[model samples]
Target: VAVTIPVSDDPTLPCLTFRFWVLATIFSILAAAVGAFNFLRYNQIALTTFAFILMSYPCGLLMAKILPSWKIGFYWPSDFLFARGTFIGGSLNPGPFNVKEQTLIIVAASTNLGAAYALDILSIQRLFFGPNQNPNNVGWAASLLLLWTTQCLGYSMAGLSRSWLVYPAAMWWPTNLVTANLLHIFHSDLQQEVVRDRLAVFKKITVLALVYELLPQFFAGYLSRISLVCLALGGASGKLGIAADYSPGRGTGVGIVTLDWAGVSQLGPLYTPLWAQMNVLISLMVSSWIFTPLLYVSDFWNAKSYPITSTGTFDNEFRPYDVSRVIDLQTHDLVVAKYDAYSPLMLNPAWAIVYAAGFAALSATLVHVFLFHGQELAEGFRSSRNPESEDVHVKMMRKYPEVPFTWYLATLVIFAALSIFLVEYWNTEFGMRWWGVLLAIAMAFIFLIPTGIILAISNATIGTNIIVELIYGFIDPGKAIANTVFKTYGFNSLHQAHALASDLKLGVYMKIPPKAMFISQFYGTIIGSIVNYAVMDMLIRNVKQIWYFTHHSPLAIDNHWNAQNPPVFYTASLIWGAIGPQRFFSGQYSVLYYGFLVGAIAPVLTWGLHRRFPGSGWNYVNFPIFFQYWGKAQSNGFANCLVSGFAASLTSQFWLKRHHRTWYDKYNYTVSAGLDSGSMFTAIIIYLV
Candidate 1:
C-alpha cells in the first residue's frame, strides 16, 4: 500500500549571487573526462538521470560566494534555471528568442502534473507494486490524458480564486520575487549596459561548458565518478563506513568525498541569496553532519543496520520493503497473513528526524504567519473588496484588464468532466473512485488559503502532502493506489494554484497585462503539457534503470530516479497511506501524527517569548523555516555541499556586506549568475551530448 506523496516543497532561493565559474571549469573537465572514459570503457554514459539538476545546486552556491548583491544579477538565460527549464528550454531556442515572462508563464501553464509526478506514480503502481508491467504498454496514453485532466481541474480551481489571491499585494509569493527581479533586468527600464553585457558573456560561456560535458556524458563515463572517498576506500568500507558514504553518488553518509562538481552540487546556490545558504549550512551541519551521525551510531530506530542517511525503509534483514508482495490484488487490502512476517518500518534516522521536523515546520508556519502578518493578511482579503486599499503592485496592475474568473470557471468545468471519466470509467480495479476525487478537491480548497498565506510571506513552503496524505490515510485506509491518486488531486492542485498565483503576483509586480499573462499562460500550458509528456515518455523508454527495477533485494535501489526523492515519497506514502497513521505511527511512532499539534503549539510558545521579551531577539526564533532545512538532505547531502556553501556566503553576505559595502553592492548577484550559468550550461551540454 506504500505510495509516494506528490508534493512540491517550494524552496525560497534569494536571488543574489552567480559566483563561481572558477570551479565550474574544473568540474566540467572532470565531468567530461570521466564521461568520456565511461562511454569508452563501458559503452554507456556514466551519469544518465538528471545530472544537470545536481550541478545547478552548487553552481548557485559558488556564485553567491564571490558575487556581492549589486555586483551581478540574474542567471545566464536565467529562465533556463530551476525546474522551469523544460519550458525555458522550449522557448529559448536559439536566434534572438525573447525569454519573456509572458512566454514563460505560457510554458508554465502548459507544463502540468504530467511532467513530474505521473511517471513516478506509474512506476510505483506497475514496477514496484503490482503487475510488473511497462507503464507505456497498458492504458498508458489514457492514464497520461486522465492525469492531465486532473491537472487542469486543479488549475481551473486556482484561476477561479485569482481575484482574492492575485489582486492582493500582500499575497506576494516570495519565490516570484527572485523571478520578477531577474526578469526586470530585461523587461523593465533598469536594464543596465553592464548587466546585458554580463548576461551575454554568461550565455556564451554556458553554451560552451554545456557542450564540453558531452565527453563525460558520452565518452568518458568515469569522469562523473570523481569520488576520492570511493577511490581511497575502494568503495568497500563495511558497516557504518564513513569513507564509503562521503561521495555524492556512492555514499550513504552525508559528507563530500570529492571536489567534482558533477558529483557534489545539488543545492542551487547560484540563485540563492547568501543569507539563505548560511542558514542551510548551519542547519545541515548541525543535523546531517552532527545530529544524523550521532543518531545512526546510537542505533536510533535500531537503524544501524541501514545507511546513516537514506529515504527508503528496510526490513530487519535490511531489505527494501516490497509492499506489492503484501498488497491484496482484489480487495486492495493488506494481506494480514503476510503482514506479521514483514519487517517493522525503519527509517534512516536522518530522514525520520527530517519528517518529524517537517511536521513541526507545518505548524510553525501557521503560527509564525499569524503572529507576524495576521493583520496584513486580514487587510489583503479586504483589499480585494476595496480597490483603493490595494498595495502598490495591485494598484499598478489595475490599469490592465484582469483575466476574467469565467475563464477559470470554464477550465474547471471541462477538467472536472474529464476527471469524472477518469474516476468512473477508466480501469476501476485499482479503485480511484469518484468520491476520492471529490475529497481531493475539498482538501485542496481547505489548504489553499493557508498554503497561499505561507507562500506569500516566505518563498518557503511545506508541502500539503502531509495534510492531504494524512486526511486520505484515514478516510481511504487500505486503498494504496487510490490514496496516491487522491493525493495528487488534493495536493498537486493546491501547489499548481500557488504557482499560478505566484505568476499573477509577478505580473502585478512588473505590471504585465493580465490578459496577456493569461493568454501566454494558456499557450505555454499547451506547449508545456505536450513537451513534458514527450520528454517524460522518452526518458521512461530510454532510461529503463529509472522505470524498471533491476533486482529483488533489500537494497533494490535504482540509482537514477530512486535517489531523486521518490523513495522518500514512497516512505511517506507507506506511513500515512498503506500502514495508516493508527498502527504505523502508534506507540513509538505516535509522535509523528501528533507532530501537527506540536508544530502549532511551538510557535505560540515562541510568539509569547517574542511578545514578552521584545528586546531579547525571541522574534528571530523562526522554527518553521529553520526546521525546513532538516528535510533537505533527501534532496542533496549536507557535509561539503552545505559547509562550502556557508563559507561562500559568510564572506560575501556577512563580512563583505558589512565592511565592504561598495564591493558587495557591485557584485552581489553578478558573481552568482556567472557560476550558476557556467555550471548549468555544462549540465545542459552534458545532457545534450
Candidate 2:
C-alpha cells in the first residue's frame, strides 16, 4: 500500500463542489452515450476509465479557469404577501481542481464507462426472439425497469461487502492502483523535476501510441496480426493440408504476432500480475494450439465439417441452425415435434470446449477462494465490524462521515421489489416468476466474495453467466426470456457489485468521502442506464440492418456494426433455454457435465500441493484463471495478439521489474495509461472520420 498508494489526507479539499457536480454530470452523460454507441459496433471500443482519468483532468482545469467564483444560491419563496426565502449558496467554481474533486469526477464518469448489461437482454429479445422481435412491441417502462433494477441491485451487494472487499488492505485491487498512481501523477506538483520528467514521458508515449495506431487500424490492417506460419503455409486458403491451422484471420492463430499496442494491451499486460498473465498464456497454448488442433484433426464431434471457430450453433447437416424452424411463432418456446424432426444442436469443437471451460472456471473460483483466501476473508469481515483494526487508508477516511448502511439497504430493497414486480406482472413477456428473481439474487450473493477476491488480487474475474444459465435452464427450461432475464440479474448484479467495490477501494486510496463516492457512482449508474436504453431503442428502430441473423446492413461491412454479441447471446438462449441444458448436455456433450467436478477438484489439489510444497510457487497457479482463459480464444476469435501480449508482460513485469527498478516504478503505469488513452482516442477519431 505504501509503495503503490500515497498515505496522506487533506480533508479540507472540496469534493462535491459546484464545479465537481457540473463536470461529473457532463462526463457521466458523455461516457454513457459513447459506451452505448460503440457497443453494437463490430470492433467494439471501450472508452476506458483511463480515458476518463486523462480527459477529466483537462476539463476540470478548464472549468476551474473559465467558471466564475461568484456564489450562487437556491431560493424558495414564501406564500405570504411579505415573502421571505430560504437560501442555499455556494461558489460556481471551487478553490482549485484538487484530487478529491478529480477523483469524484473520474468515479462518476467511469461508473458509466460501458453500456448496461441488461441492454444485452433487451437486444437479444428485440433482435432474435418471439413476436416482440420488432422494436415497436418492446415497452419502454418494462425495459427501463429491467435496466435500472439489474444495474442497481449490485450497489446493495457492494455496500454489504464493503468491509471485507474495500476496507481491508489485504484485498488490494490491482487495477485501481494504476488509476490511483496516474491520478497522483496528474495532480502532483509539476514544478518538481521528477514529476515533470514523468509527465513528459506520459505525453511522449501518448503521442507516439496515437500515431502508431493508424498504421495497424487503417493503412495496413495486416500489421495488426502477422502470422509467419500462415505465410509459410502459403496463405489463409493455402493448398497446404493444414493451412487453416495458422491463419490468424480465419483459424486458431497459432504462432501469430501483433505489432499493435491496442491488440497487445487488450489483456492489460503492463498492469495484470505476471503469474496471472502466465496462467492465461499457458492455458491458451495448451487449449488453442494443442488441444483444439488435436480435436479438430481427429474430427472430434465432427468438428472438421464446420468452421474451426464459431459461436453460432449448427444443425446436423452443418449449417447455421434456423432457430425459427424449431421455435413456435406464437408461444416462442421450442416446438418439440419440429425440433425432434429437424436435428440435434451441434457445436464446433472450440465452442464446445468454451462451454466446458466456463463451467470449470465458475466452480473453480468458489472452491479456490474457499480453500486459499477463506481465512483472510473471515479476518477482514471481522475487522470491518471492529474499526480499530483498520489500515492507514481506512483510518484516514474515518474523518469524513461514511455512507450509512441503511442507504444501500433501502436502495437494494426498492430495486429488488421493482425487479420482482416487473418479472411477475410482465410474466407473459419476461417468462420469469418472482422466485426466479430471488434465485438470481441468491446466486449473485453466493459468488460475490469468491469472485471479488480473485479480481482484487489477480485482476482476473470468473463470470457466473454460464453456471447461472445452467442452473436456471434446468429449473425453468424452454423459456428463453426467463433464461435471459435470470442470467442478466444473476451475472450483471455480481459484475456491477465488483465494479462498485473497485471504485470504492479507489475512493479509499484517494481519501474521497465515502458519501461523495456513493453519490457519484449511484448517479452515474442511473444516468448511464437511461442513456443505454435510449441508444439501444434508437439503433433497433432506425438501423436498416442490425443483426446478420435477421438481415445484413452496410454498417456490417468490414465488421463495423455487425452485431456479434447478440448472436452469441441468442445461441446461448437456444442451447440453455429452449433446447434445455438437460437435452443439450446429454449424449455427445455429457463430458461437459464433468467440468464442474473437474473445476472443484483442481482447486483442491492445487491447495494441497501448495501446503505440501510451499516453496514451489504452487500458490501462483490459479486454476480459475487457467480454466477461464483455456477456451477464451474460441469465443474471442483467433489468438492474434497472444505473442505480443506475452512479450509485453515479460518485458514490463519480468525484465523491467528486475533489471530497471527505478524506471519501472516511476513510469510503468503512466505508460499504460498513455497507451490506452491514445489507442482509445485514435479509435474514436477513426470512427468519426
Candidate 3:
C-alpha cells in the first residue's frame, strides 16, 4: 500500500525569489563567519549564536517590499510565500526566499559551532595557552583538514543507510517537529484557508516582546534581577552569615523572578520540548536543588570552602587545585612528592556525586538500549537492507537511488585514514598513538546505532564522553593530549553522526534531494571547520587574557565563555591524562567504577518488572534517561537555568500542552522564535553599544 501525495502537473519547482535568497544566505554566512571571528573575541559564545532564522524574519519582511518593485524575474514576487506545509508565509510572502535554501543556509551556519568547539578543547586551548608543556606544533593546514575530515567521515555514514532510523514515523524526533513547525511558521502561506493570520500573530508577539525586552535589557534593568533574597542580603555571604550566600544565583534555593527568557535559554531554551525539559528539571531538582544543598550545608567534600555549584578541583585544605603545575615536565606524570604535598583532586560535593552518577548513566544507556531497542535493531537492519516493503516514507524514499553504502565505507576509511595520518605524521607533543585513534573511531561506530536510536526516540542524546575518557584514561594515563583527542574522536564523531542523521530526516520530510542534502552536510562541515578554526585563531591571537581561566584561577567564578564547557575538556585532559583515572576511579575514587554495575543492573531489574506486570507502568519509566540528565555543571553554567527552566517547562510542556494543544502548536515555535530573535538581536546591540 504505497500511498503517495500526487503533485499537480508542474514542470519545475517554483523559483519564488532566487536573488534575495542568494543574497540573504551569503550575508548570513558572511555575518556568522566575520561576527564569530571578531565578536566572540570580546563577547561570550551567545553573541555568535544569532539564529539565522531570526535574522531571516527581518530579511523576509524586507524582501517582501523590495523584490516586488525591482521587476527582476518572471515571477516578480507574485506568491511571496509557498504553502509547502513546512514553512510559513506573510502579507507579501517575500519573493526571493523559500524553504529549501533556508534549510541549507541554517544548516551551514550550524556547522560553524561544533568544529570550533572541538578544536578549541583539543589542540588550540593547549597549543597556545595552558596545561600542555610542549604544545602541538602542527600548522594551520594540518589542524583544519584533520577536524574537517573527521566530521565528514562520520557524518557521511548517516547518509548511506538512513532509512531505518528515519522512515519509520514511530521514531518521531520530536525536536524536528518543532523545527518543521518553526519553518512552517516562516514559509507558510498567509492567504491559505486552514488558519490565516499566523504571521500577524508572530509579528504581534515579536513586537511586544522586543518592546518589553527594552526595559530589562537597557533601561532600569533592575527589573530583570527581581530576587528578594539577593536584595535583602546584599553583602553578607561570610562563613557564618544567616544569608548562607542565599543570593539569587549566588546562594542555594531556587532563584525566582529571574524573568529573562533569553538569558535562561542562552543556547537551548526555546527548542527543547516540554517533555525533555520536564525530565531534566525533575532530575535537577533531585540532584542540584535538594541533594546538592544538603551535601553543601553539611560541608561534604569541603563544600563550605568551595562554591556550591562548580566542578572546580579543590585541595584537601579547600584551596582551588591546578594540574599544570603538578605535572612533571619529563615524565608527563604527576610528581608524587608535589602531589603528596598538594591536596587530592577534590570537587564540590554536587559534581563529585555527578561523576559517580555519570558512570551509572553510561551503563544505563547501554542497558536501556538492549532492553528497549534490541528487537527493533535486528528488524530495522534487515528491512533497511533494501528499503523493501514498509512505511510510505521508506517507499517514497526508495524512488531516489540511495547513496551507496560503499561510498560511506570509503568516506569513513579515507577521512579516518587522514585523521590517523595527522596523528602519526604530525607526531606533535600531544602524544596520540595510532592504535588509540583507531580505538576511538571504533568506539564511535559501536555506539552510533544504539545512541542514534535513543536520539531518534527522544531528542536528548546522553553523551558517552565519560566512557571514552575512561577507556583512553586507562590506555594513555599520563598523556593529556592523547586522551582528549581520543575522546573528541570517539564522542564528537558520533555527536556529528547524530547531527547528519537528523538533517537527513529533515531532508526526507521536506522532500529535499538526498544528493543535495549530502553535499550540504559534507561540504558545509568542511567550510565550518575552516571558518571555526580561523575564527578561533584570530580571536586567540587578538584578545588578551581571553582564554578560559582553569578551575584553579580565582577569576573562573565569573559567568563568561571561558568558565563554560571548555574547562570540562581541559579538566578531562588533566584528570584522564595528567592524573590518570586509575588513581581516581579505580584507586582513591574506586566507588565510581561500580557505578557501571549499578547502572547495568538497575535497568535490567526494571525490564524484569515490566515483563512481570504488563500494565504496571514500568515501561514508561526511562531510568537511564533520568540518570543521564542527572549530571550538573559548575556554577553559572546550569545553576541559574534549573529553577527558571523548570517553571517554563511546567508551563509549556505540561499545562499548556495538556490544556491547549491547538494554541500551543500554533504559537509555541513562534513565541520561541520571537524570544530567541529579540534577545539575540538585543544582545548584539548591547555588545555593539
Candidate 4:
C-alpha cells in the first residue's frame, strides 16, 4: 500500500458535481454501445476502464477550463407534494477537475463497459432455441427484466459483504492498486520530476505500442502465433501422427509465441503477481504439453477421432453433434427417445478436462479460503464493528456518509422478486420455474464470500458457472433454457458481486463518498443494461446471418462477427443441460466426478505443508488457480502467448521490482495501462477503417 497507493487523502475535494454526471453518462453510454457491439465479434474487444481513465482525464480538464462557473438553484413551490420548501443547486464546472471526480466517473463508466453476462442467455435463446429463434419473436420486456435483475442483484451481495471484503487491510485488492496509482499519475500535479518522468514514459510506450501493433494485427498476421514445431513439420496432414499435434493455429500450442501485445497481455502479465502467474503457466504447460497429448495418443474417450482441441461436442460417429435432431422444437425440450436412439454426446479430451478442472477449481476455492483466510475473515468482521482498528484509507473515508445496509437489502429484495416474476410469467420463453430463481440466488449468496476472498487476495477468480449448470441441469433435466437461466442468476450474481467489491475498494482508496459510489454504479448498471439489450436486439433482428454457420456466411469470418461466445454457450447447454449431467457424468466420463474430491483434498494438503514448512512458499501454491488454468486452452485456443506473457511478467514484476524499485514503483503500472490503451485504440481504429 505504501509503495503503490497514496496514503493521504484530501477530503475537501468536490465529487458528484454536474460535470461528473455529464461525463459519466456520456462515457457509460459509449462504453455500453461499443462493448455490446464488439461482444459478438470473433476478436472481442472492450473499452476498458483504464482507457476510460486516460480519456476522461483530458475531457474533464477541458470541461473545467471551458465551462462557466455558474451555479443554479431550484426551489420547490409551496404547494409541492413532497419537497415543499426544499432547494437544490449545482454548477456547470466544479472548479478544477480533481481525482475524486475522475475516480467516480471511471467507476460509473466501467460498470457498463462490458456486455452484461445475461446477454449470453438472451443471445443463445434467440439464435438457437425455439420460439425466440426468430429474431422478431424475441421478448423485449423479458429480456430487459433478465438483464437488469441479474446485473443489479450482485450489488446487494457486495454491500452486505463490505465489512469482510472491502474494509480489511489484508483484502487489499491488488488490481485496484494499479488503478489507484494510474489515477494519481494522471490527476496529480505534473511539476514533480518523478511524476513528469512517469508521464513521459507512459506517452512514449503508448505511441510505440500503437505503431508496433499494426504488424502482428494486420500486415504480418502470422506473427500473432509463430510456432516452430508447426513450421518444421511443414504443415503435414497428420503425417507424423500424434507427434505433429502442436500447431499454434489449429492444435495445442506447445512451442509457440505471440508477438501481439493484445494476445500477450491476455493473462495480465504486467500486473498480476509473479506467484499467481507462475501457477497458471505451470498448469497450462502440464495440461497442454504433456497430459493432453498422452491422453490423445492413448485414444482416451476416442479422442483421436476429433480435433486435438475443440469446444464443440460430437457424437459416437465423430460428427458435430446436431442438437436439432435430439430436441423437440415444439416444446424446446430434449426428446429422450431420439437421444437414446442417436449417439450419446462426446467431448474431445481437451474440452472434457476443462470441465473437470472447472469442477476442481470451484471446490478448491472454498477449501483454500476457509483454511488460509479464515482467521482474517473473522478479524475483518470484528474490525468492521470496531472503528478503532480501521485502516488509514477507511479512516479517511469516514467523513463521507456510508450507504445504508437497508438500501442494499431493498435492492436485493425488489430485483430478486422481479427475477422470479420474469421466470414464472415468461416460463414459455425462460423455461424455468419461480422456485429455480430463488435456488439460484441461494447458491450465489452462499458462495460469494469465499470466491470474493479468492479474487481479493490472488487477483484470480473461480467462476461458479460450471457447478451452477451441473446442479440446475440435474434438477431441471432436458430444459436447456431453464438450465442457462439458472446458471446466469447463480453464476453472474456472484461474479458481479466481486466486481462491485473491487470497485468499492477503489472508491475507498480514492476517498470518494460511499453513497456517491453506490449511486454512480447503480445508475451505470441500469443504463448499460438497456444499451446492451438494444444493441443485441438490433443485430439479431437486422442481420440475417449474424448467428454462426448461417449460409456459410463469409461476413462472420471477414468482419470478425463469427459469434464465438453464443456457439460455445449453446454447446454447453447441450452437454450439461439437454444431455443431463446424470447421464453425461457416468459411463466413459465417470472419472470426472473425482474432480470434487481432488479439489477439496488438494487445499487441505497445501495447508498442512504450509504449517510444516512455513518459509518454503507452500502457501503460494494456490491450488484453485492451478486447476482453473489447467484446461484454459480448451476454450481459449492454443494460448500461443504464454511464453511472451511469462517473459513480460519476469521483467516487470520480478526484475524491475527487485532491481530498480524506484522506477518499478513509478512506472510499472503506467506501462501496463499505456500498452492497453494503445492496443485498444489501434484495434478499434483498424476495425473502423
lDDT of each: 0.54, 0.82, 0.62, 0.82
Off by over 4 Å in 4: 43-46, 76-84, 132-138, 229-250, 383-390, 547-561
Displacement of residue 48 (Cα, Å) in model 3 is 7.9
**TM-scores for candidates 1 onward, in order:** 0.71, 0.93, 0.82, 0.94
Compose the digit string of candidate 2's lDDT tens values, residues 1-689: 57657788888888888877887888888888877777676666657887778778888888889988898986677546776688666788867788989899888888887788888778877776657433345588998899889988999999988877887767788788778888888887899776787789888988998998999988889888787776875676442222343332256777788888778887889988899899988898788777876777788888788776666778889998877789877666888999989988888877788888888998899899889987766776563445553557988888999999899999888999999999988877788999999999999999998899888888888878888998999998998878989999999999999999999999999999999999888888888788888988898788746765345544555456677677777767777888888878777898987888899999999899999999999999999999988868666643777888999999999999899988888888888888987887888788778
Give candidate 1 misplaced runs (Cα > 4 Å): 1-114, 123-145, 157-279, 329-333, 383-391, 427-430, 531-576, 615-617, 638-640, 656-667
Q: With candidate 4 superimposed using the best TM-score fit, by how many Å does residue 400's alpha carbon deviate from the native?
A: 1.6
| lDDT by residue (tens digit), candidate 4, 294-402 | 7777888777788886667778898888877887776557788988999788878777878888899989988998999887667756634555535579878888899
Evaluation by lDDT, superior candidate among 1 and 3: 3
User: Candidate 3's error at 483, in angstroms?
Assistant: 1.4
- lDDT score of model 3? 0.62
Model 2: how far is 378 from its true place, Å? 1.3
RMSD of 4: 2.8
Per-residue accuracy of model 3 over 1-689 as CA lDDT, tens digit each: 01111121111323224433454445445544654454333354343323666665566556655755433333434455862232333233334456665666555555554334356454434433343444444558777766776667567557543655666655556556545555655665667632255566656766776676777777767555454444566754434332232342255534434566665663254556555565566775577556776776788656677776656677667777767667765445667677767756776666777777888877787888889767666666774443342445544565566667777788888888888887787666456878877898888877777777777776677778888988888877777777777877888788888877887776665555566566666655666666666766665555434453433445444333342345556666777777877766543467667778888888888899999997896765666667777745343345455666666767776777789877776676666666666666665666667
